[model samples]
Target: MIKSGITDSRSFPAVSIHGDLVITGGGLSGVCCAITAARQGLKVVLVQDRPVLGGNASSEVRLWILGATSHMGNNNRWAREGGVVDEILVENTYRNPEGNPVIFDMVLLDKVVKETNITLLLNTAVYAVDKKDMATIQSLHAFCSQNQTTYTLTAPLFCDASGDGVVGFLSGAAFRMGAESQEEFGEKFAPSAVYGELLGHSLYFYSKDTGKPVVFTPPDFALKDITKIPRFKTFNAQESGCKLWWIEYGGRRDTVHDTEEIKWELWKVVYGVWDYIKNSGNFPEAATLTLEWVGAIPGKRESRRFEGDYMMTQQDIVEQRWHEDAVAFGGWSVDLHPADGVFSEKPGCNQWHSKGIYQIPYRSLYSKNIHNLFLGGRIISASHVAFASTRVMATAAYVSQAAGMAAALCIEKNILPADIFNQYHIPSLQQRLLKTGQYIPGLVLQDEQDLVGKAVISASSELLLTAFPGATQVTPLTLSVAQLLPLDKGTVPSFTFQADAQENTVLEVALRSSSKPGNYTPDITLATQHIPVHPGHNVLEIQFPVELETAAYVFITFMKNPLVALHVTEKRVTGILSVFNSVNKAVSNYGRQTPPEDIGMEAFEFWCPQRRPGGQNIAVQCDAGIHRFKAANISNGIDRPTHQPNAWVADWNDPQPQLILTWSQPQQIRYIDLFLDADYDHPMESVLMTHPENVMPFCVRNYRIKDAAGNILADKKDNYQTHNRIYFAALVTTDRLIIELEHPSATVPAAVFAVRCYGGEVGQQL
Candidate 1:
């Protein structure tokens, strides 16, 4: 290599790249957006300022990703965000069950690089925006410190997902940084000035045990007195990394311009806390522990929120309001933190949950001022109160996926972003998102192009819910537990349960259901029974004197009784679960949420499911079987369970389960999409928590597709994902198709949510 002579001035190498869509962040939201657009035939350029993707989820920050499921702490059933984000999360669970942050980084990188249509720029920060006109961005100018080069990225559509809305700021997009007044949006839960108008930044640290004593020397900048932190007493030797999410700072100051100051303050807090843990002699167990990693950057919570066509508010979330142009959904509680962060005497956070998942409209995704600009992640147009719920990584990714799809439609129709809704294209957009496994609340796929609608579907056997065989396991009734059963409009069925009582006691049993059919709140009590139990064994007969007018999920609740233990079954099925009315400290669930009357938050009990290796169903037997799982449900257009069990579940006793689809005439078929069960109730946190199993227990591990002549078209093995798309080498003309499936486990039944067939050109698998 030849060295150039020093001159008065020198410039770094300049490069220009062009694409159909340009995304300005590499967080989960931006990564999902890029992948979605790229799959929909749009050339995408993903520009990330950091060395790795996942932003706060990367090893540098190490915050676990959470969304609607809220660690399975609320009533939102089967509520995980789908599409590209689901794929990433599912894949991460399959490959990285240990949830190592560094492994998560590799998963994101692998997904982005696999998409040929996506051009990813790592360690590149966008500094300048070039406008084609007053309201449209023509290109962006970015500099990569590692490469020492400047890049000019040009695209017709741009998505600003940077944590601080960097592109939106440079492009003059209208944005709000602080919380709005209570009167501005009529938000009763809006924070007052004393409580702080903005959320703060958080830094995390990890510690390791060396089996021997380790010395810790405090830095000059380390905080001297840990007592200054009000909640310092709550810290313990076992809690490290994101478990100490309360260690936050820099909310009173400008979060964007003063990020460095905020990070330094957070650093001081972390080092000082560690100093107290290691040198304070308070934690004897931490004597052999050493600092493994400390976050280099703080995880930002609130920043500049760019304005779009519509702004989501508190009422939209609390009321679970429906949107005409709904594209995404959010279910996390409205969680807010104090501006003083760790130093404040106030509690760590204020979280208020809604009864059900709320729909996000398409109007809140694009910048109103900048014509070609799309706002994503925490920067999406939403009031401060609403942003608290939508700011989570999974929800952000779900919303960003919609924006990416809208961008693709813009290119295909040669129209602007707003024109998509104005021209009655929202239905088409919704269908496309559904095809890719994106779940919009209360929406079902209605694609007329799918040939499955024209076929008569039949299954070898359908599950008749009569009983869940009891195993050797028996769980104590420490907290109230309920068995969720989907029932039709009729008299409640008589159920029998096997229970063991330590002493003679009266076991209170109640039948309940959600006021809203689609939700799982279990707020309305239908009937109650006080059953007298014996000391050793009891076969309790539960009969409710109630009749239902409509079909819904009824909850058979057995109230908390320390003296009783109920039998639990190992048998797992689709659209069925056992929930408990208890506290999940991780999500702020405290048995029942009793918010202030004027806060505009609902007061209800939290009925949530437990995770695997323990969340077994309660053993029950019924006189009349509930036949809800029908063969025709495979073509019902709904992918996940909603108000009813919208799935075809085979009986557990069926030796070889199969589904056959027969048409009137021979038709050319090239593609088939199978939607299976992936246990959506599990939160599947991206990092810091280990999952029990790599594959979801309800997914079909092996399946085969055969044509009319019994020739195998596709044979899939060890499938763990929810969406399975099969493409044939060429078009095959057949009047009938048979799908043979193997259950994921002997105890779990084989279930399918939907099966869609299409006649199209064969393409590479996505």
Candidate 2:
């Protein structure tokens, strides 16, 4: 150990370690940052201050994992986070359905241990940083209490996902704390003037019934009068865990420096509240309930927010602005709280929901001044209002994943984060993220490597005629609804649609193509036709001939004057979906009156019959059973999960589903990556409950891979989860590859998201 700063007055002992990237946090975002970088073959040293990996969601704090889904409520449907967040949620729901905090710890720890490139340092707190120059970090110094050893870790890049932006703060990076003035960012939701007040911290408790009489003894520090608390009216004895997020404090001062004091104050409130429930309870039902646990550490909400190239504002979220460098997306409402917390007479929080998902630009994930510094989680660059929406665990994880990948690319290409976008590597970064199964809203994965995209693509079944037996009656008047129809170069002469008119109505139908291939909704109008319809069930035909340069989606819309009842079928296609929009209604959820329905945020989601795969689509087709859920989705490189139906699935009656890939010439391949459908019926919520099955019913439980020569390459009988990567023993050059799938149950079908193949030499390994 080389000691430099040693004098007669003072001596310091230092130990040195080296890595490519150093992450100073073990929270969800930090864990994801380390895992993503490590997976890309970068040596990462993750130094977490806590004993466990998860920071807020750990046993010590017991905060539930909240994200873009907003607990599957609040109208933000089908927006669960992907990548590492998805993996953790699936594993936890399958293994520990009750949402046990201890089990959750193991799940997080297991994933970190599985990655060989990551060096984890638990109980190590990074408090200081060494800078090489004014713009870059050189090393980090952290103390591990368990080993009583101080570590000096050096790296080329560093990520401050420590929830408070500690590394960046110590390195003298520019940052902002508390709320900004309305004039500064022009955020209408912001305060009139700047202030140091923040969102505060929370500590939760857990309790369960013992089915017997129980007694509680209140400590001396417990508040004797519960009536004095403003939020006491909403307090319930049965409330535990996340339900107690309202019990917060320390927003009036520095949330980080005064955490210990805040923790003590929270303990008093929690115990006092429990005492009110157990002893002062007006009902006898609480006699059998006992306090299971209480958090000793407070889960902080906000502290020092690092400065980035872009500062996301409330206007950006409310307007749903699409950024050119958007690498991740968020949909959670802008949830801001009063600084007084529980002591305040006001409600716990103020929330403003978005009409749809919004983009989080990559520019906000890296430091503005420190060249090699990247920050994520609660500390990313954003105003108090914008941070309110992006501070959730899952959104932060996505940002962390993007930052880690960008760091890897920075090392791989030998450039800075800003240079990545400057050199036109944003597309490359997005492609890598998409290939890895992270869904970026409004972005399509046009995989050039997918051989199917090169050929004349066709499906086994493209037209959906039959609606589910129980269909919802939707009468859309003045509003238009449309579905994406994948059309080839061949002209589609005409298409049929089903509708039940209450009375005589004139229906205007139009065929529109997507303005851009990546966009989901149809923007450019191609043709229009008017059809007179009578009452009762009517099969209307609209003659529309269309030709495309490439195989892409052509949308057909029906506009009803008097709200004609449309029949929705049960079948849903992977890429094809139904969309609706109206110019009549304005956004009404937020408290403040704001202009609504911009051209971009005009599309509104409507619930249709949960159909069989491709069961309700109205399109012109050449074959009878050519299912729209085709093998092409496997190579399309989009994995939007099982619930959204952006995956390939077989017919229910088809006993065996076999997908075969053939090339004109022999191709050498070594790796085959598969993304299966894990049922997303189980929602992410604060309350814990178990689902019927860990794996989805339609998932391919049994599968086998074979070559054209009839040689078995790989097989698995009882498959589970959504992702699998299989590497062959040696490079196998073959023209044809076959994959046969079987359902776990006789009634269920089979499905897959993507099937990616890589080319390499015989000696190559993954």
Candidate 3:
């Protein structure tokens, strides 16, 4: 059928495209996949049928982005999706807290366009696929309505992130729709028998007050008798936007085939509801209120869920079942809606939350029969009950990140996607994910090439000599004296101390060069100063100049003020000045800002002891056993919470805790990643809630990097939050390098999760 293009052909001209990866759908999941893959240096073609990106969360649907944390409710706590999804949440939280759908569209657009490797095709709907023996997809044809062009994109791999499972359907991938029988997955919430009816679609509207009397007129299509709608009995003019998620339809029929009918019905409901508010004369607030926007397309919920290598079940979520190949996690509740949607006489949806979070295995991301087909978003392989929780945009984003990374690795290894798991290739995959800041619960990364694992470890403070677990109980104690320091400087410049203020008050501090430098307690008061402080746990510093030539011991003392209290611990170290007993009174652990409840005395030591049970030394020094803070743990890649606590902590005397990586020979290192334990105590909030203190108080405020020759490489200062990873400007070859950290807060000791170095090996990137 080859015809001369100059005269004989009047048909639509076809365009051809090629890439390493082709993704169908432009929702949150597809966008995440494309960004991640393209950043890994892969050519990606992201095709979407919609005019704008962000599927249901787009301007067309206007649904708010909801995710695993369940709006920070259900005690899910800090369980927000932390990878690419977190990038969106953090950026949106900082840029668009008011939650404007239009602004969100721009945020997503900016993220996609910034990646040079991604070729985004908007308003291009893929309706057909070319498959190789029904096992692998070779290419797909899409029609771009905006440009009136037909494009065929070919790739080695394909992902069906389209919410409706359109690509999978054309490829003939095994899929299920609607509710399943209770006996199928043993799901308590499933219907007694299988049914094709599915969860319906929802429409939303935005309204604002114009501050003037506004008139209203109802179209003929508007529902005249609003009393027929049951949910409207309590509806008022004040409701609109996300508050109206209950405005739904199309669950009782084919969701895709009946989209027009569903949209028209939703229109009637929306206009009818507005008519009642404006003309029914029931509410006075409607007199000046005007409709800002109404969603043109309904945000559809449940649809075709393609079958994968493994299917997630409700039992797995409820029991928090562990998976060997787990690549992501979900904390959202098992949310299921009625087949009748808004018209249902029963409640719209039923939900049950998990105790914490459940694992999502990689097996659930690819098609069971198709060789190169992977899935993301709501269409991922799962039973109806399991799909309820994983369908949220945030949770789906994590799945997309995992799939994208896996695809990159698959291409690099010249292996099929399924071989990544079958051939025991998960360790490398997991490590790469963690390096990119994708956190997986209970997984720890161990670097075999870290030369610091062979060095001798030592510190400047003697208060770190306690056992790994430290004291079993907190003891009440107090400190009257502190460590003596011998410095090359003739004068003692400055020092910081931790104190708990019973109220807003001040504590008097005195520093003296110890006549007896070997003594732990203050021998002589050289200088006395008064320091003003605030309530709560605080680290305050005092500066004064007291010249003392030759070797000197600095003795510090505090006035016995009841308004301020210092921390005491049983953990002890050597070769540095320490605190001496000032007062001993047994007090309950209750009402204390910090913990080690039984260890606090009337007088306390300057060094704070963190409770850690398991860690191995990375250095060979005799005092290495005494220095409980292992340097190797910095890059072991386990991100534990403050309560569960897996962190490397140094004594309070040293402002800089340095991790030195040394080798017998030079080691080439081009990248250094530092994961600081940002004291993850507070839950992640999806709304505009601000805390009195910055997030992760224990995170380093500033730092400097130096090589063995004492050359400064990089000095980062005044940092907030945590650095996922920092790449060096160029490769450095040396016997050793050091990372020195400054405490973010005076009260707490510096904590770090991992310090990772990358180089010396080929192909080390995503």
Candidate 4:
């Protein structure tokens, strides 16, 4: 190599790439979008400004990824976001249970590079856009600072997921910066100017014990006056990283243009906080602690929100409104932080949860002015009130997956993004998304090409829920608890529960269910009964004289009684859980939310399940056994549980559990997709949270597929993912296909959600 002397201004190496789609940003949203599109047969170019992917979820920012599950802090039971994002989360849990930020970076990189159809350009920032017309982008000009190269990327479709809406801004897309007024969208929860119009930026740091005394010296620019922060007294030596999410700033200022200035202020705060912990006499435990990592950039919460065909409003989220063109769903609470951030005297954030998960329309995912531009991440069209709910990484990733799939369809049909919604192509879009394990609220898979619909399905043994053996452990009834039971459109089953009372007292039993059929809010009280208890063990029968109109999940609630203790079992089943009316401070739950009448928010008690190693099932016996887990459920079109248990669960004692599908005639099958249970109830936060197990306990660990002639078609071991697709080199003609499965744990029965088979030429992986 020879060194060249600079003469006139020299340009760096330039490269041009042409693809079917171009995505700006490497956050979870953009990364999932690229993966989804690439898998659907689109050539994609992904441009990320940072050295690593995941944006705020990256090692630099280190914010944990969350979505509808909401840390299992709300009533969204089995409400995890699906498709590519689910895969990423499951993979992270398997590889990095400790939630190491650096390992999470590797997980994202591994997922992106494995997609052969995607060209990932890291450390590349898109600075300019060339438009074919005023309404369409023709190409993008990007520069990679790390490699000193310039790239011109051209694509038929463009998605702006850059967090700041860089591509949308450069392309002249319609956008709004601050919150909308109450009169603008009839959103009573909309904040006033005095309360702050935008959410702020946050920086995080990590601290670790060195096993010895460690001294810290603050920089010259460090914040010397910690007392200036109104909430400085809340900080402690044990809390670090996102636990200090209230340490935010830069909301009143321009979030986009003043990011650098905002970051400096955050740095000063972090160093100052550390200095206070090291030097302040109150935190004696921090003597052995040292700063392990400090974020270089702030995690921005709000920036430019682009305008799409339809703008989501507060009612859409609070009312759980349905959309005919719905392609994705979100369940996180409407969380908004104070604009004054750390310097404010107000509470860190105000969060309001809905009764259930809500659907997101396709019309809100593409630009209104820029014809070829698609919006993803926090930039999707939504009012500030709605954005508070959809801004989380997992929700953004889910919405972006829908955008990516829509882009593939647009390229295949040679149509614009709006045409997909206008021309009645939404049903086809929903079906395609469902086939890939993307759950759209109130929608079931109706694929005509699936061969399982034509087959006769049978299982070795189906689980008949008659009783859960008790005498394992007794939990005090300090908080009201409920057992969720799937029921049919008939008389409600009478439950017999064993409980011990410290003194002679009356136990109140209530039967409740959500007003909506499929939701788990327990908002409607169907019936109530009073049962008398003695000082010793007593068997009590709870009989609800109510009849169900449709299949639903009913809750048998036992009111809190300090004198009573109920028996619980270790046995766990698919699509069944027990919840308590308790508070989880992390999600702002306080047992019951009592807002002022003028806030336009509903007041309700939070009934949520506890994390594993604690959330055991309430032991109960039914007068009549519920036989919903039949062999035919494997072909029911629904993958996850909704109003009822949609899975074919084997008997607890079945030694050789198998699911068989037999066609009338020999069918040539080349692809088989199996949907298993991954415990969707678990939030599986990507960082700073430790999980009880790497794999979900309900998952099928070992499985094998066999043909009519007993030939082993495919064998898998140590499996954890929910959706498993098996591809064959050549089509196998078989009238019968047998699936043998082993339960991951003896306590959890083997279960299969759905089985789909396809014949002929190989198409998309899904």
Each model's C-alpha lDDT?
A: 0.92, 0.73, 0.68, 0.93
CA lDDT for candidate 1: 0.92
> How do the residues 600-688 of candidate 2 rate in per-residue lDDT, one tens digit apiece?
12333322212223224443233322234665666665676322345666665566677777777777778888888664323443234
Of candidate 3, the 10-residue stretch with the lowest lDDT total is: 613-622
lDDT of 1 by residue, 372-469 (tens): 99988989999999999999999999999999999999999998898888899999999999888898988888889899999999999999999985
Candidate 4 lDDT (Cα, 0 to 1) = 0.93
The alpha-carbon deviation from the true structure for residue 330 of candidate 2, after best TM-score superposition, in angstroms, is: 0.9
Tens-digit lDDT track of model 3 for 383-415: 888898888877887898889888888888888
Number of the top-ranking candidate, with lDDT as the measure: 4
Q: Between 2 and 4, whose lDDT is larger?
A: 4
**Which should have the higher lDDT, number 1 or number 3?**
1
lDDT ranking, high to low: 4, 1, 2, 3
Q: Alpha-carbon error at 669 in model 3, in Å?
A: 1.7
